[model samples]
Target: MEDNYLTMDLLRFTTAGSVDDGKSTLIGRLLYDSKSIFEDQMEAIEKASKQKGEENVNLALLTDGLRAEREQGITIDVAYRYFATPKRKFIIADTPGHIEYTRNMVTGASTANLAIILVDARNGIVEQTRRHSFIASLLGIDHIVYCVNKMDLVNYSQQTFSSIKEELKTFSSKLRTKDISFIPISALKGDNVVNRGKNMEWYEGSTLLHTLENIHIASDRNLIDCRFPVQYVIRPQNDKFHDYRGYAGRIEGGVFKKGDQVMVLPSGFSSKIKSIDTFNGEIEEAYSPMSVALTLEDDIDISRGDMIVRKNNSPSPEQNIDVMLCWLSTTPLQPGGKYAIKHTSKDARCMIKNILYKVDINTLHRIEEDKKIEANDIARVSLRITQPLFIDSYSSNKATGSIIIIDEATNNTVGAGMII
Candidate 1:
């Protein structure tokens, strides 16, 4: 049972929607209906719900952990929850809905494989819905499941759900994501979320949990271009293992096998994989998101920030790159300011070469005249790095194509960028 649990694949998903769109309630329903909540947790939420003068148990209290969030009945920060079913494991990032907290949504959704966007059946499509959808596409999330929630309030009308679905279809046609789906649900009444509620016999589709368990995510990884950035060099000097030299890191792309011909970046030295080592022993092969130490046949000069790739399929070394940057700091981005840059395992200094344009996320238009980038602003900018980086386009491989900017004085991450 333990082995089966460990081997079960995980799916990380984020929930986004307008205020009161039932993002938290939907996740809480999943946890409660799946029997993931403990007795003590259920008791606590039940007590709190009574104190708040609710008629019934408030399931949203399961995720709204902060005191401010509970007091205000709003999610102020990103609340993460974990649960599992027999088929798969799950991580849920319940992000804030306010436009001011858009950066929180980006932080939570950066590594997600899918996004669950809620839409209130009564209100239909709105601004926040479009904003979150655009950001999900920008982050390259492949699958989007829009839950048309609160069907009970709308009398579970098929026409209401159909109208919202049509509007979403028309708006999402402009999005880059291809695999989009819709499900009518009543999170408060426990309908069409975990079980196929009888109230929705008119609708024919899998439940949200069923969709999450069976979605095809294995093909989403970049398997053609091999990218392995060296995070650390392991050298254990002892009598039993005196000659142990291994380059350790997480594989960013493609599959690496024993005896595969690999090239070290920057130095351009060539070698073959001697072994792939893990705590469980040597593995025959490794792929993206797997952490392992690799022993090479040749004793090349390799260190952190160096990347190992297939000789025939290597990322180009770049010094000047264009990126879509999301500014996260309070201080506005300076035109020619210099900042520390961290990309994959490589660290370097970069300067803002130019600001091409800012994006009005709601309208999805390029604002060429508004060049000043403030907090929560997304813009296209050019950066000149001190060292050449091995990079692929963000659309091609997210692992090798994202960067973070740190403020030199405070040592805080101020911005995130996606390579164009």
Candidate 2:
């Protein structure tokens, strides 16, 4: 909400691909052509490129900001990059392409409105492509742009591009991805990147940057089930107003208004919404994704970790939860392991009750036997929380529907879970 450029409609997207698929180059091209690159940054990359004795500038270096990444010339960690175009402000999560870093892709894609899955045009769809697509589907990413990169190597042949696109359509159809688009691009040579390419006149779609800025992402929030997790209680006894009690937090789902009957979860205390307050003054209404505080007509003991919702639209409060977890720590996720489960503004201890299955990403097969889930591995597991959790399926709402497992001692996020 700061001084954003004209393109203030923020677009959060994640890029994913196999090694050498040119994901980084495509991102760098976007940032460069948009003139989001500063003179100093460009000069630094130019200097580094000359030091490496490269014939041309290594555009990928713009996103690979890690020192170890530069030395090895491979991305081993997720790098977040920000850039803006005249039509939109964008955040790109440049995740690693290696199969070992599947967890990184999930972490990056979890909050993404769209995902760009790149493929080498010459290679077609490979195992890694299938894996990335599957994970994207599992994480509920709505949009996918398949960039068939390295088109220069393929002679920019429309036949080659169409053939690869056909194969991709056939393979990706088996996944649960809701929407997908295809583009032929040479991230290194800049064909069909930021502008239309004369060589590929047969392709009629807009450039990657245009598509990103114009995508229909306005209808992504859940405005049906009202959820407000209390983050703080504001009680100020000022001279003008002796008694002021307000429960403040961000709305995770649905809408709220004055006179709407609300229920306090975990306690099941029913109350009528008296007024919704904001810094500007009392607002008549509020909805999902907005931060506001509410004052009930009759205070019935609402506190932090308590959720306010429409009585009939409230999510289930349960202790036993089934989740799909991606292991993130070096320590393996063992059965019966205990960790702190944090969901929304609530936190409690939970134990891994059972290992349901480990998904073979490429095959979409559930392996019931192999349960040795280590770092970067994803498995469906059951957990028992010390207290009740207010959750909806991850497919419905992303905020109240997901949780993270934190190590009690180190406080490291060891795993992320999507409630099933």
Candidate 3:
């Protein structure tokens, strides 16, 4: 049972929508119906609900743990929750919906495999819906489930659901995400959330829980381009292991096997994988997201920030690159400003060579006239790095294609960028 639990695949997903679209409530419903909540948690929620003068338990309380959020009845910061069913484990990032909290949503959804965008049935497709959907696409979330929430308010009307679904389809057609789905649900009334309630008999879609448990995410990882960025160097000089030299890191893409021909970047040294050692023991093979120490056949000087890739298939070395940058700082982005850049395991300095254009996320248009980038603003910009980086396009490999810019004086992460 322990082994089964350890081996079970985990899914990371984020919930996004406008204010009061029921993102938190939907997550609460999942945790409750799945029996993942403890008795103490339930009792606390019940007590809090009573204090708030609610007739029924406020499911949103399960995730809205902040005092300010609870007092104001709005989620300001990202709230993360964990739960598991027999089918799979889940990490839920309940992100804020306000436009000011756009950076919070980006931070929560950065590492997610899927996104659930809640749409109020009464309003149909709104501005926030389009904003969240576009951000999800920008973050390379291939799977998107647009939950048509608050179905009970619309009397669970099939016509309303159909119309909203059509509108969503038309809007999402412009997005790069290929896999899109729609589900009608009422987080408050628990209709078609965990169980298919009788309120929507005309709807023949799977419940939200069922869809989450069975979404096809196995092929979502990049398996063709092999990339392993060395994070640390392990060398035990003890009596038994006097000559041990290993490069320890997490694989970013593709599969690596013993005896595979690999090359170290920057230095461009060639070596074969001698062994792949994990915490358990030596493994014959390792793949993306796996942390392992790799021993090379030859003695080579490799250290942190060096990438090991298939000898024939390697990321191109780039010194200047174009990126879609999301400015996360209060100070507006300054053209020709130099900042510290961190990408994968590598670190370097980068300068803002040019500010190409700012994106009007709601309209999906490029605003070339406006060069000033403020907080929560997404823009296309050119960067000139101090060192050549082994990189792939963000669309191809997320792990190796994303970068963060840190303010030199403040040492704060000011921007997040995706390689174009």
Candidate 4:
């Protein structure tokens, strides 16, 4: 089983590819090969396989659970599956591959640490490949695993793999990608996915499982910028601790320690960290992703949505900001529409100030003529918020650097923006 139950470790991974590139199959194979599936689940797939008259069991059947999905043999929604090996526990987001479902890919990849871009060996690279990589980079995902799937169909040729690798290198160079690695594997024949394949003797790298288990993801967060937006206030009215007041929140950035000075955002009032409180008792320091109730030396009327950050390295407070937005609504984005702007935990009413230009993601050219940006389209736009937002560049900090737009009428997320 995954060490999560034992150690509370979790890895969130998302799969991306063109339709029929075998993203679902790859996830099923990983789960099956890792012995993460239960016997009852295996039996059900085996029975389903016999009914379908397939030569071999469709491993993808394990995850394609919807009746409409199984009938059509297509992944429509973002199917989240959880499985674990002794070394690690994984939450896999099997994202839809259709171009129309670009929003689904964005939703799945929002919290992912690594993205597995599956590419068919026969097709090589395509526009969807570029789009997927662009979205990964935009979302601040550091690691990219280019799994060249269906290697058995290519006769396990190194030439084909090398050609794809070179093309990926050339294409990825134009993108703002940080870490990229290529691996050849046949998800169908199970080569180099969980075990080394004898057919591909020239390749020398650990299997995909090894890569997932050992990737250096510990230092991915920006440790220099300390951002703690209080989510809730804990006050227990008991006899023992009647006067206890704590600020409950998740650490969004850098290390926080006792006696370190922190400034509440927009207020500019400085205070010292009295102590860091956790269920396990008091701690001296904390970092990003850790949930703790912080006790400050002074009670400065702090509440939810209020940010506690380092006084020296604070973000610029501004109302007007430039952003790269990926439209997610069917209604085309109007240049001057009012919407609910959510930055970190703080909410504000914002009006679209200007529409700069929409970029053709397939070709990376700005389409000046196309002013109307529809669903799945990326564009550069400016916003004028009613309240000032404290943020850093999206390229530097994902937490403080990103915002999601929700429509006032329907209350749906209409777009995602990256602060520039």
TM-score of 3: 0.97
- lDDT tens string, model 3, 264-303? 9989999999999977999999998899999999999999
Error of 4 at 178 (Å): 2.0
Model 4 bad stretches (over 4 Å)? 1-8, 67-76
Please, what are the lDDT tens digits per residue for candidate 4 over residues 1-420? 543567646788889998898887888899889988899999999999899999888888888766484546442367788987776788988788776667778778888999999999999998889888888877778889999999999999999999999999999987776789999999887898888879899999878988988887878878989999888999998998787889999999999998999998878888999989999999999999899988888878887878899988988898999999989888998789999999988889899999999987777789989799898888899999998898889888888899999999999889999899
Where model 3 places Cα greater than 4 Å from the true spot, the runs are 1-3, 69-76
Q: For residues 231-303, what per-residue lDDT tens digits would candidate 1 score against the true structure? A: 9999988888699899999999999999999999989999999999998999999998899999999989899
lDDT of 2 by residue, 128-159 (tens): 88888988888888889999999889888899
Residue 418 of model 3, lDDT score: 93
- The candidate with the higher lDDT, 3 or 4, is 3
Q: Give the TM-score of candidate 2.
A: 0.94
Q: Model 1 Cα displacement at 387 (Å)? A: 1.1
Candidate 2: give the clashing pairs. Answer: 7-87, 7-88
User: What are the runs in model 2 whose C-alpha is more than 4 Å off?
Assistant: 1-7, 69-76
